[model samples]
Target chain A: MSMNDLIATIKKVLEEVDVVLGWTRSPAAGVAVPARFHTPDEADGAIFDSTCTHNLAVHLPRLKNSKVGIVAKGCDARSIVQLIVEGEVSRDRIRVIGVPCPGVIDVKRAWRCFGFGKKIEDAGGRVHMEGRSMPREEILLHKCHQCQDQEPVIMDLAAGDVKSVTPPPPPDKTGIRERFAAMSIAERREFWREQFSRCIRCYACREACPLCFCRDACSMQTREPHWTGGQVNAIESEMAQQVRTSHLAGRCTGCEECERACPVGIPLMLLLEEQNRIVEELFAYRAGMSLEDKTPLLTYDVNRDGGWR
Target chain B: MPKTEVKIIGFLCNWCSYAGADMAGTARMKQPASLRVVRLPCTGRVNPLLVLKAFREGADGVLVSGCHPGDCHYNEGNYYARRRMEVLERMLPALGIDPARFHYTWVSASEGAKWADVVNEFTRRVKQVI
Candidate 1:
């Protein structure tokens, strides 16, 4: 669906809710920002395009009590389903306007295609910056390349028909899981140690995550019986990562925003991918699979689940 | 390698497994000295972080023992522990930590011989892993 059509749908959705959450054209060239529209006039300003990288449902929790409408991509809509399953929000309070996502633009790769600079127009598509056109191959995020859901599983209205495009052949399966499996145990440990050592204890990863609603009381910042010390080193960083990833065991939707937000480019998604696999293997559970499916980590079955052995 | 000593952290529930270990001592049952037991009120209290800390502190193995299914003194702590440890153990290998280094079992207060056997066997596995 084009940006104009998306705004038209959102404008209709705005009549039923106080505000809607969706991507708006950013001041930054070749980017989209999460925008909140309280009125239909403001709704017209929202844009849907390749650069709408954010999972806008991340804003829903803050506006949970309000009747908030959201322009959810496949992933964003799934996140909302997971949130409802976890009892974070009720379905009645929030409205969903599912939009067809052709795949969002990866900002880092887009910069490379734009030769580190670009210009912006609120209208979607074709990063119009100084006669520089970002090749389609370079702009789509890796998640988009492997995107399983082009159309949202759940939605109240669609702006227009979802684009029917064959997802490119699955990329060479050089994902971290296969790579880590090939490495020796000691080598794997050394690899993660080096990657985590580069973390400056920045909380960007935590901030970008849509599911982590811990807010000011997050364990990372606790003092009494602190979860992790303020020390800026590998062990502490590793500990923080472990606690977070484990907490998200069956809840992470594999959004990859944590890795995207990490300033140091730590391979955080690799850890989460491995974790999601374990959840699937052990509990036959996948995050955002269904609204009726309870999170496995929070509940256990006696007959189906026993000891790890 | 001159028989590098294997260190194992044993987290025992106060009601059943800890008493089971004590009975092993009173019965003069010999067990490996490799175990460093930390008694908690219930297996449910055994935080995954504690096991991670044990590994970080150079424990070659970690063992958690509690009441049998349907026999937890706190009614369902061991049941909860079973699931938690299962998830944690499955995830350990992803961090390059050998899943063999962690073990969980049910031990009743009357099972003194079983307590000795669990320790000896776990010590052997840790020795092999380290």
Candidate 2:
């Protein structure tokens, strides 16, 4: 369906629900931002563009007690299923209006698309994608190409007509593991040191993550005596990286929001992807794959056979 | 090879592995003194992060020992520990740590000799690398 038809459906649904959560072009930027529509009239600004990279599922748990209507893409729907499985949100409290996304564009790719000399400006809720005739494929988000599922896993009301699309192939984690293995110890240390040095201790990544639900009591915020000093030095950087990565070990849904939110352009998703790969290899488990599957870490079995001990 | 002093942290399940270590001491079984044992309620309580944290805190090696798989005092504690450790073992090498540095073994309360042997072998291997 056209973007107009999708917005019209969302308008109707927004009038019936307490709130309709969707993406609106950020007022000050070329990026998409999450917005809540309580009235049908406000739906005109909602756009389902290639820049709509924000996963709407992050808002569901916060509005769990209230009836909410969400505009979700495939990855967003997967996150919803995961939240339901974890008992973080009730399925009955939310209505998912699914959309099939081809792929969203990364900001760096957008910059490159616009060319080194040219600058693209955001004006009146529209992005002018201009430069030296760059192909659209060049600007697409890396995760979208690797996305295995295009159809929403769970949806109460799908907006566009359902289209049968082949899921992307399973990620080649062995290749990725080999790349890391090939790096020398000094090279690995230097790489991480440079990446972590750029981190300004901005918790935007944590705040943007849908699964990182811990609020004020965040590990990074403990300061009575200060577990690790608040400085963005190497020791503190390493601690922060370890703490953040470990927290998302089994829980990360591979949303990539944390990486996107990082102003420093840290490849945070690589760490998460590695963790996801490990989880898959060991237990044959995938996070956000199904609402019915419980986390392997939280569940125990006496008769289970294939483990180390 | 130059001999490097390797620090090893051993997490022993209180019900079995810790008792097994005590039994080994009572039996005067010779074991490597490089290990620092932390008594946990059960091996299942050992989060993979703790193992990583051991390495982060300069432990050259980590050992998690529990009751024989089915003999968990909590019935399924060791089984859960086994699953977590197995996953950690597979992932550690990718994170730039030697996979052999993290070891998981089952030591029953009566297996004093076995516990000593496991520690000696693990310490020796860690020494070779560190």
lDDT for each of the candidates?
0.79, 0.76
Model 2 ranges with Cα > 4 A deviation: A112-128, A164-181, A184-186, A223-229, A307-309
Write down the worst ten-residue block by lDDT for model 2 chain B: B87-96
Clashing pairs in 1: A50-A105
Worst 10 residues of 2 chain A by lDDT: A117-126
TM-score of the second chain for every model: 0.96, 0.97
Residue A86 lDDT (model 1): 84
> Which is the leading candidate under DockQ?
1
**Which one is best on lDDT?**
1
B1-130: candidate 2 lDDT, tens digit per residue:
8355778999999999899999999999998789999999999899777887788778989999999887989888877777778767876654567777889999999999999999999999998777
Least accurate 10 contiguous residues by lDDT in model 1 chain A = A119-128
Residue-by-residue lDDT tens digits, candidate 1, B7-84: 889999999999999999999999988999999999989888788877876788999999987898988787778877
Where in model 1 is the C-alpha error above 4 Å? A119-139, A162-165, A172-177
TM-score of 1: 0.92
